[model samples]
Target chain A: MTTYYTKSHEWIRLDGEEATVGITAHASEELGELVFVEAKDEGTEVAAGDTAAVVESVKAASDIYAPVAGTLSGFNTKLSDEPTLVGSDAEGEGWIYKMTVSNPDDLKGLLTAEQYKSL
Target chain B: MSDTLHQTPLHALNLELGAKMVPFAGYEMPIQYKAGLMAEHLHTRSSAGLFDVSHMGQLRIAAKSGDVRDAALALETLIPADYAALGVHRQRYGLLTNDEGGIRDDLMVANMGQDLFVVVNASCKHQDADLIEKALGDRCIVTRHFDRALIALQGPEAQNALTSLCPAAADMKFMDAIETELAGVSVTLSRSGYTGEDGYEIGIAAKDAETVARALLAQPQILPIGLGARDSLRLEAGLCLYGNDIDPTTTPIEASLAWAIQKARREGGSREGGYPGADIVLRQAREGVSRKRVGLMAEGRAPVRAGAKLFADAEGTKEIGVVTSGAFGPTVNAPVAMGYVATEFADVDTALFAELRGKFVPVHVRAMPFVAPGFKR
Candidate 1:
C-alpha cells in the first residue's frame, strides 16, 4: 500500500484498485472547525479533481475534490452527525470516502508525502 | 479604502494567543483563536468570552453649552432615536439615517451626563464623523476618540468575572454605562454586548487596553474569543450587522428596528419628525413598508448563505427577497439566517424557500433571538 497527496490537500491511500481518501491535517487546520460535510453517495463515479464532497467550517464552506478518478465505493456517513471528526482526526476516522480507482496511472501524478509537505 | 490594513492595540496580544488574523473593516483582526470558533462560542455561552473590539469607532458628542440634553437634541436631527430623554449613564441603540429615509449606520449612544458617548461601526466611523460634523457641527462638538479601545466581555459568567475587578459593575443594569476603574485603569464600561449574553463593553484608553484585556482573560471563567464567534453569537441573537442585515439602502422601519425609534420621534409625538427622512420614515411607520426583515430557520443543516435569493415557491419563480446574513449557529446547532422578504410573507412561521447552490431549500420565517438572551435586565 502507498499514500499520495494532491496539491489541493486531499490524501489518498491506494491498495491495489481500492483507495481511501481524506483531507490533510494542514488543510483541516486552515479550515478551522468543521460544522457540516456531505459526501457523494456510494456508486457515484467521480472524475479526478471533481468535488467529491462539500465541507463547511465555522468561517466558510469548501469543496473536497477527488485526487484521482474513481467510483465511490463508500461514503463516510458518520460525518453528517459529527463533522468535527475531520478537524480532530483528518487522516484516520475522519476519512471522507473509499473508492475504486479507474486508472492506476493516475497515482503517478500525485505528490509524495515529502512533496506535499513543502506545498 | 487603502490597501494598507490597520492593526488594533491588542494585535500583538491576539497574535500571542494564537489568533487567526483576517482583514475586517480595513483592520487586521482576530477571527478565532487556537480553540477555534465553536469552542470560543460555546465557552462564551457557558462562561465568559473576552473580545477585542477596538476597531469600532468611539466618539463623544457634546453641546457647546456643556449640556448632554442639548447634545442629544442636536443628534436627534441625524438619528430617529429619543436621545434627549435618555437618562444619564444610560445607553440606547441608534441609527444614522440618510436624507432619503435609509440607514447610514447603526450605533450605540450613551448619555454620559455632560456628553453623549457614541460608538459606530469601524467601516463607517470616518464617514459618520464627517456627517455629524457637517450636519450638527453648529450645535454639537463632535470629538472622535482615536486613542480609545473597546473590549467586550460577554456570556453567562461575564458579570461575575467583571465584578471581580469592578464591583460597581454588578450594580449596573442592562444598557447602563458608567465610568469606573478596573484594576486601577479607568474605563467607560457599559452593561451591554451584541452576543445575546449578559456582558459589558469596556471603553478604555488605547494605552491601557492590553493591560485590561489581560486582566479580564486572567479570570478562570473567561477565555479570549474572536470575531468568528462574535458573528455567530450576534446572528443567533438576531442582531443585525451594520453593513449586512442593515445598510444605507434599508430603513429602520423596513429592517424591523422601529422599536428603537422611540415614540417621541414618531408621528404625533412631542418631538415628532425632526430627524432626516422623517417624513418618509413617519409615513412608513403608519402606512407600513413593502418589505420587512425576517429571521430564517433553514430546514436542514446546510447554511443558507447571504445573497441567496428567496422565492415564494420551490420552483424558483416569484423572487421575494435576499438573505443578508446567514450562518451555522453553534448554539442553535442548526443553520440560522436573517433576510428581507415581502411584508406579507414576513410573519413568524411563514414558509419560504431560499435558493441554495442550484436548488431551493425550504426555510421558514422564524422569530429571532434563536438562543434566549442572557441580559441582566
Candidate 2:
C-alpha cells in the first residue's frame, strides 16, 4: 500500500487497482470551516487531473482535482450533511471518494506521504 | 494588512485571544477567533459573541439651545428618516443621502436625552460628522466621543454576560440606552447592535475600554469575534452593512428602508424641512421604486455570494439583479443572501437564479431577515 499527493492538494491511497482519495488536511485548514462539498458521481470517468469536486467554506470556494486517472467508484455521501467531517478528520472518515486506478504507475510520480508533509 | 488601518483599544486583546484579524474600514479588527467563523457565528445566534467595535467612531450630537429632537428634526432634513419623531432613550436606523438620492452611509441614532446622543459606524464617521455639522448651523453641536471605545456584546447571553460587568445594564430595553459604569468605566450602554440579537453597544472611556472588553470576554460564552464572522452573522440576521448592502449608488427607497421614514414627513402637515433630494424622497414614498432589496434562499447547499448575478431561472439569460450580501447563514444553518431585484421578482415565491462560477444556482425571492431578530425591542 502507498499514498500519493497532487500539487493541487489531493491525496490518493493506492492498494492495487483500488485507490481512496481525499483532500490533504492542509487544504481543509486553509479552506476554513467546510460548508459544502460536491463530489463527482459514481462511475464518472475523468481524463486525469480534471476538477472532480467543489469545496466551499464560509469565506472561499475551491476545486479539488483528480490526482490519478480513474473512474470514480463512489463518494462519501455523508459529506452532504456533515462537510465539517473533512475539517475534523480529512484523512480517514472524511475520504471523498474511492476509484479504480486506471494506471497504477500514476502513483509513483505523485508526492509520498513524507514529501507531502513538508508542504 | 494595510499599514493605514486603524487599531481599536482592544486590538492587542484580540491578538492575545488568537483572533483572525482583517482590515475593515481602515482598521485592523478581528473577524473571528480560534473557534473560527462558524462556531463564533453560531454562538452569537444561540448564545453571545463579544465584538471589539472600538474602531467604529462614537460621537455626540446636541443642540446648545432648544430640544435636540427639534434640532434633530432640522438635521433630519438632510437625511431620509424622520429623526424628530424618535423617542428619547430609543434608537432607529437611518441613512445619509446625496442630492442624487443615493446613500452616503447607513447609521444608528440613539436618543440619549431629548437633545443629545451618539451615532456610530466605521469609514463613514468623519463624513457623517461633517454632514451633521454642515446642516446644524447654530442650532446644534456635534462633538466626537474620541475618548470612548465601542464594544458590542451581542446574543442571548448578552443580558446575563453583561450583568457581571454592569449590573444596571440588565434593565435596559431594546434600543434603550442609559449611562452606566462597567469595569470601573463610565459608559453609555445602548441596547442595540448589528447582529439582530438582544445586545448592547457599550461606549466605554478609551482608557477603560480594554478593561471592559477583557471582563466581557472572560466568560465562556463570550468568544471574541472579528470582522469575518461579523459579515456572515449580519448577513444571516438580514442586517445591512453600509458598503456591501447600501452605498453611494443606492437609495433608501431602493434599499427597502422606507420604514425609517417618518410618517409625519409623508403627511406634510408640519413645516417642510429642507434637505437634499427631499422632493424625490416624498415622491418615492408616494409611489415606489423600480427595484428593491430582498432576501434569497437557494435551492441547494451552494450559497449565493455577493456580486453573483440574479436572473429568472425559468426565463433564461435575462439579467435582473445582483447579490449585495451573502453567505451560508449560521443562524438558519443554510445559505442566504440579500440583493436588489426588479419589483416583479420581490415576491416570496419568485423564482430566481444565481450565476456562480458559470453555474446557475436556483434561488427564491424571500422576505428580509432570513432568520428572526432578537433585538430586545
Candidate 3:
C-alpha cells in the first residue's frame, strides 16, 4: 500500500483498488478538539474536492473534502460516540472512511508526503 | 492579522502557556491553550478558570461638585436604566440608547461611594467614552481608566479561590462591588462576570496585573481559560455578545432584555420619558415588539453557528430569523443557540429549522441559560 496526501490536509492510503482516508495530524491539531463528525453515507458517489464530511470543534465547524472521485464503501461509526479519536490519532483509528477508486488515474493528482510537507 | 495589535499585560504568560493567539477587538488575545476548547470549558464549570478581560474599558463617572446623586442623574439621560435607584455598592445592567430607539451599547454600572464605575464592551469603548464626554461633560467628569487591567476568575470554586486572597471578598453578594486589597495591591473587586458562574471581576492597575494574575493561577482550583471557552460558557449561560447578539440595530425590548429596564423608567412612573428613546422603548415594553430573541436547541450533534438562517418549515422555504450566537454547550452536551425570530414563533417548544451547510437541521425553541447559573447569591 502507498500513501498520498492532499493540500486540503486529507491523507489516503491505497490498498489495491480500495483506499482508506483520514485527515492529517497537523489538520486535527489546528482544529483543536473534535466534538462532532459527519461522514457521507456509505455508497455515495463523490467527485474530487467535494465536501464529503464535516468536523466540528467547540469553536468552529469545518468541512472535510473528498480527495479523489470514488464511491464511499464504509465509514468508521466509532466517531459517532467518540469524536475525540480524531484529535487523539487522526491518521490511524480516526480514519474517516473507505472508498472504491472510480479511476486509478486519479492518483496522479495527489502529492507525495515529501511534496505535501514542502507546500 | 495586523502587526499593530495591542498586547495585554499577560501576553507573554499566555504564549508561555502555549496559547493560540488571535486578533480580537484590536488586541492579540488567546483563543485557547494546549488543553483545547472542550477541556478548558469543562474545567471552568467543574473548578475555576481565570480569563484576561483587560481589553474591556473601565471608566469613572464623577460629579464635579462631589454629589454622587448628581452624577447618577446625569447618566440617566443617556441610558434607560434607573441609576438613581441603584443602591450604593450595587451594580445594575444598563443600555446606552440612541435617540432613534436603537442600542448603542450594553454595560454594567456600579454605584461606588462617590462615583459610578462603568464597564463597556472593548470594541465600543472609544466611541462610548466620547459620547459620554460630549453629552455629560458639564454635569460630570468622565475619566477613562486606560491604564487599568481587568481579570475574571469564574466557576463553582471561584469564590473559594478569590476569598483566599482577600477574605473580605467572601462578604460580597452577586453584583456587589468593593474596594479592597488583594495581595497588597489595591483593587476594585466585583462579584459579577459574563460567565454564568460564581465569580469575581478584579480591576487592578496595569502595572500590577501580571502579579495578580499569577497569584490567582497559583491556586490549585484555577486554570487559565482562553476566549474560545469564554465564548462557549457565555453562550450556554444565555448571555449576549455585544456585536453579535445585541448590536446598534437591536433594541432592548426586541432583544428580550426588558428585565434590565426597571419600572421607574416605564410608563406610570415618576421619572418616565427622561432618557433618550424612552418613548419608543416604553411603548415596546407595553405593546410588545414584532420580533424577540429566544433560545434554540439543535436536534442533532452537528453544531449550528452564527449567521445560520432560520425557517418556519422543514422544507426550508420561508426564512424567518437568523442565529446570532451558537455553540456546543459542554454542560448540556448538545448544540445550543440564541437568535431573533418573529414574536409569534418565539414561544417555547416551537418547531423550527436552521439552515446549515445548505440543509435544514431541526431545532426547537427553548428557554435560555442552557445551563443553570451557579451564582453565589
Candidate 4:
C-alpha cells in the first residue's frame, strides 16, 4: 500500500473510497511517547486543515489537523487504552482515525514517503 | 538546539524518542517524551520511567586514609542530615547552606565507600562545587565526577525492571548502593529514586554511559522520560526540587524540611554543628518557624504554574507568599502545587488565592503528595 505523510506528521492510506489515517513515524518521533490521543469521534465532519485530534505528551499538547476534509468514518479507539502504540508503530497500527476524503486532490499538497524523507 | 543550553550524551537519543527539548540549568534536557505530561505521569505511577539526570553534577568527597569520618562530619555540619548515623550501602538527602540560615542547594548524598558520592542540581553545580571546595579545601579532597552518567528508574515496576539489567539488584533495599554490571556496563548502582517510587539511580563511567543507557531502555516499563515528567512526578510525590522549591532565599525550616535536621546536631552538644547558619537553624528547632511550605490546590484546567502570587484572603488580608512550584496535577487530574505561605495560611484547607494572568485564582491549602508516592521503601 502506498503511504503518504502530512507536514503535521500524519499519514493517510487511501483504500479506494475509504481511507485509513494515523500519525507518521516522524510525527510520533517528534511528539515523543504518545501519552494521550483524543481522536475525532467516528462520523465527525471536519474540513481540510481542521483539527481532528489532540496529541498530548508529558511536556506539551498539539493539535492533529486533517489533511483532507471528510467525515471521520471510524477511530482507533484502542489508542485510549494503549497510547504507546503510537510510538511503536506510529505509521501502521497507530493510525488515529479513518475518514472519507472530501477531495483526493488535497493529498497533492501533502508529502509522499520519499518527499517527507527529503524534507 | 539553542547554544545557551548544554547537551548531554543522550541529546540525540532524545530526538530519536521524540522528546521536547528545553533549556534547563544551562543544558538542553528533554522535558517530556512522546506521551504528554498527563499520560507520562500516569505511566510513572503505574510503571517505570527512565530519566537521564546526567546534567546533574556528580562529585566525590574523599578523605585520606584516616580523616574520612571527620571530613564527613564537617560536611554534615552545613547540611542538616544525619550522615554518620547513615548505615553503609545507604543514602540520604542533604541541603547545603550559607553563613546565614539560608539554603544553598538540595542534594543527594550516598556513602560510596572510602568517599562520599554527591549529586547536586545542574544549574547550581558550579556554586555547589565551589562551596564544598571552599568549605573543606585544607581539610579533605573534593573532586568532580564530570565524566559520569546518572539515570533514574522510577515507578512501581522500577525495581523489577532494573533488576533485569542487574540481577543482584533484587536484594537491594531503598537508599542502598551496590556495585553491579548494568546492561554489560560497569556502574555503581543505587536503589534510590526521586519520584518517591521504587527505583535506582545508576552512576556509570561517561564513556560507557550510552551503552548502559541503551541497556536499561531495553527493559520493559522503562520509557525514556524527560524533565517535564520528572518535575511533575516529583511534585506529585510532594518532593522538592532544588532551585524552584528550595533556594538560597529559603531555609529547611521555612521549606517544611525540618525533619532533615538531626536531633543531636540541633542540640549542639556534639556530633556535627559548627558549620555555617547553625545558629538560626538551631533557634528555629528550639522555637518555631513563622512561614512554612504548604501545598496548594487550584480549581480548574488552567494551571496556576510557578511564580504565581499567593495571598491569604478576607480577615487575614496579607500578601503572604508566592508559589515556587505549581502545575496541573496529571495524576489528580487537577491543578496542584507547593509554595511558602504564612502560618495563618499554611494550614491545610486554608483558603488562598493564586494570581494567574492578573486575576486571583481561588485555591485551598491541600495535603501534598497530590498522588500517593509508591516508593518500594
Candidate 5:
C-alpha cells in the first residue's frame, strides 16, 4: 500500500485498484473543529479535481476534491454521527470515503509524504 | 498577511495561550485557541469566558453645552435609537442610518451623565468617527479613544469572576456602565456584551489592558475565548454583525430591529422624524417592508453558510432571500442561520429552501435568538 497526497490537502491510500481517502492532518488542523461532513453517495463516479465531499467547521465550509478519477464505492458513515473524529484522527478513522480507481497511472503524479510536507 | 495589520494589546498573551492567529478587519487577531471554537463556546455558556475585543473603536461624545442630554439629543439626528431619554449610566443599542434609511453601522451608546460613551464596529470605526465629527462637531465634541483596549467577560459565571476583582460589578444590571478600578487599574465597565450571556465589556488603557485581562483570566472560572466562539455565540443570540447581517443595504425595520428604535423616536412621539432616513424608516414602521430578515433553521447537519441563496421552492426557480450569517451552533446542537426573505415568507415556520453546493435544501423561517439571553435584567 502507498499513500499519495494532493496539493489541496487530500490524501489517498492506494492498494491494487482500491483506495481510501481523507484530508491531511495539516488541513484538519487548519479547519479547526468539524461539525458536519457529507460526500457523494456510493457508486458516484468523479474525475480528478472534482468536488466529491464537503466538510464544515464552526466558522466556514470547505470542499473536498476527488484526488483522481474513480467510482466511489463506500463512505465513512461514522463521520455523519461523529464529525469531530476528522479533527481528532483525520488520517485514520476519519477517512472520508473508499473508491475504485479507473486508472492506476494517475497515482504516480501525486506528491509523496516528503514533497507534501515541504509544500 | 501584511506587517501593517494591527495587533491588540493582548496579542502576545494570545500567542502564549496557543491561539491560531488570523487577519480580520485590518487586525491580526485570534480566531480560536487550543480548546477550539466548540469548547470555547460551550464554556462561555456554562462558565466564564474572557475575550479580547480591543479592535472595536470607542469614543466619547459630549455637547459644548456640558449636559449629556444635549449630546444625546444631538446624536439622535444620526441614529434611530432614543438616546436623550436614556438614563445616566445606562446604555442603548443604536443604528447609524444613511439618507436612504440603510444601516451604516450599529453601535452601543452609554450615557455618562456629562458625556456619551459610544462603541462602533472596528471595520467602520474610522468612517463612523468622521461622520459623527462632521455632523455634530459644531454642537458637540467627538473624541475618538485610540488609546483604549476592550475586553469582555461573558457567561453565567461572568459576574462571579468579575466581582472578585471589582466588587461593585455585582450591583450592576444589564446595560449598566461604570467607571471603576480593576486590579488597581482605571477601566470603564459595561454590563453588556454581544453574546447573549450575562457579561461585561471592559474598556481599559491600552497599556493596562493585558494586566486586567490576565487578572480576569486568573480566575478559575474564566477561560480565554477567541473570535470564533464570539461569532457563534452572537449568531445563536440572533444579534447582527454590522457588515454581515446588517449593512448599508439593510434597514432597522427590514432587519427585524424595530424594537431597538424606542417609541420616543417614532412618529407621534415628542421627538419624531429627525434622524437620517426618518421618512423611510418611520413609513416602514407603519406600512412594513417588502422583505425582512428572519432566523433560518436548516434541515440536516450541513451548515447553510452565508451567501447561500434562499428560494420559495426546492426546485430553485424563484429566489426570495439570501443568508447573511450561518454556523453550527454548539449549544443549540444544530445548524442555525439568519437571512432575508420576502415578507410573506418571513412568518415563523414558513418553509423555504436554501441552495447549498448546487442543491436546494429545506429551511424553515424561525424566530431569532435561537438561544434565550441570560441577561441579569
Candidate 6:
C-alpha cells in the first residue's frame, strides 16, 4: 500500500486499484471545529482537483477536492452524524470516501508524507 | 500580523492563556482560547465566562456647569434616545444618527450621577468621539477614557462568580450602573452585557485590568472567553452587531429598533423632533418602513453565512434581501441568522429560501432572539 498527499491537504492511501481519501490533519486543524460534512454520492465520476465534498465549521465552510481522477465507490456516512471526528482523527476513522482509480498515472503527481509535511 | 495593531491591557494574559490572537477593530485581540469557539460558547451559556472588552470605547460626558440634565439633553441632540428622562443610575440603549436618518453607531448611555457614561463599538470609537466632541463639546465636556479597561462576566453562573468579588454588584438590576470596588480597585459596574445571559460589565483602571481578570478567572465557574464566542452569543441573543445587523444605511425603524426611541422624541411628544434625522425617523415610526430585520432559522444543518442572498422562491430568482449576521448557534444547536427582508415577508414563520453554496436552502423568518434572554430584571 502506498499513501500519497496533495498540496491542498487531501490524503489518499492506494490499495491496488482502490484508494481511501480524507483531508490531512493540518487542514482540519486550520478549519477549526467541523459542524457539518457533505460527501459526494457513490458511483459519481470525479476528476482530479474537482470539488468532492464540503466541510463546514462554525466560522466558515471549506471544500474538499478530489486528489486523483476516480469513480467514488462509497463514503464514510458516520461523519454525517459526528463531523468533529474529522478534527480528532482526520486521516484515520474520519476518512471521507473510497474510490477506484481510473488512471494509475495520477498517483505519480501526489507527494510522499515527508514531502507533504515540508510543504 | 501587522505591528500597528493595538494591544489591550489583558493582551499578555490572553497570550498566557493560549488564546488565538486575531486582528479586530485595529486591536490584536483573542478570538478564542484553548477551549475553542464551540466549547467557549457553550461554557458561557451554562457557566461563567469573562471577556476582555477593553477594546470598546468608554467615554465620560459631564456638563460644563455641573448639571446632569444639561449633559443628557446635549447628548439627546446626537442620538434619538430621551437621555434627559434617563433616571439616575439607569442606563439606556442609544444610536448615533446621521442627518440622513441612518445609524452611525449603537451605544450604551448611563446616568451615573455627575456624568453620563457612554460605551461605543471599538471600530467606531474614533468617529464617535469626534462626532460627540464636534456636536456637543460646547455644552458638555466629552472625555474619552483611554486609561480604562472594560471586562464582562457573562452566563447563568455569572452572578455567583461576580458576587464573590463585589457583593453590591449582585443587587444591581438590569441596565443599572454603580461605582464599586473589586479586588481593591475602584471600578464602575453595570448589570448588563452583550450576551443574552444575566451578567455584568465592569470598568476599571487600565493598570489594574489584568489583576481583576486574573481574580475573576481564579473562580472555579469563571472561564476567560474571547471574541468568537462573543459573536455567537450576541447573535443568539438577537443583538445587532454595529457593522453587521445595523450600519450607515440602516435606519432605526428599518432595523426594527424603534423600541429604543423613547416617546418624548417621537411625533406629538413633549420634545418632538430635536435629534438628527428626526423628520424621516419620526415619520417612519408612524407610517412604517419598507424593509425590516428578522431572525432566520435554517431548515437543515447547513449554515447560511453573511452576504448570502435571500430569495422569494426556492428556485432563487427574486432576491429580496441579504443576510447580515449568521453562524451555527451552539446553544440553539442549529444554524441561525438575522437579515433584512421586505416588511411583507417579515412576519413570523414566513417561509423564505437562502442561497447557500449554489443551492437554495429553505429558511423560516422567526422572531428574535433565537434564544430567550436571561436579563436580571
TM-score of each prediction: 0.97, 0.90, 0.97, 0.76, 0.98, 0.97
Collision pairs in model 6: none
lDDT of 4 by residue, B48-120 (tens): 8889888999888887555456557857856877777666667888888877788998888877767788888
Please give the distance, in angstroms, between residue B278's alpha carbon in candidate 5 and its true position after superposition: 0.3
Interface RMSD of 4: 4.7
Clashing pairs in 3: none
Best by the TM-score measure: 5
Question: Fraction of native contacts in model 2?
Answer: 0.44
Worst 10 residues of 3 chain B by lDDT: B269-278
lDDT of 3 by residue, B1-377 (tens): 57799888788888988899999999999999888888889999999999998899999999998988889889989988889888889888999998877789999999998999999999999999999999999989999996689999999999899888899989999999888999889999999998899899999998999889888989999999999999999999999999999987888999999888788887887677687788888888889999999999999888889999999999899888999999888888999999999998999999999998878999999998999998877
Best of the candidates, lDDT: 5
Lowest lDDT 10-mer window, candidate 3 chain A? A100-109
The per-prediction i-RMS, to one decimal, reads 1.0, 1.0, 0.9, 4.7, 0.7, 0.9
Which CAPRI quality tier does the interface of model 4 achieve? incorrect
Per-residue lDDT for A78-112 in model 2, tens only? 99989999999998899888888889897888998
Minimum summed lDDT over a 10-residue window in model 2 chain B is located at B265-274
- Model 6 TM-score, all chains together: 0.97
**lDDT (tens digit, per residue) of candidate 5 on B194-287:** 9999999999999999899899989999999999999999999999988889998889999999998998888898888798899999999999
Candidate 5 overall Cα lDDT vs. reference?
Answer: 0.93
The positional error of residue A43 in candidate 3, measured at the CA in angstroms, is 4.3
Instruction: List, in order, the clash count of every candidate structure.
Output: 0, 7, 0, 14, 0, 0
CAPRI band for model 1: medium
What is the per-residue lDDT of model 1 for residues A1-119, given as tens digits with 9 covering 90 to 100?
Answer: 67899999999998878899999999998988888888777898999999888889765789989999999998788988889899889999999999999998898899999999987
Compared with the true structure, all predictions reach lDDT values of 0.92, 0.81, 0.90, 0.79, 0.93, 0.92
Error of 1 at A13 (Å): 2.4
- Per-prediction DockQ comes to 0.67, 0.57, 0.79, 0.12, 0.89, 0.70
Model 5: colliding residue pairs: none
- Per-residue lDDT tens digits for candidate 2, residues B87-142, read 78777777788887788877778777755575657788888878888787667888
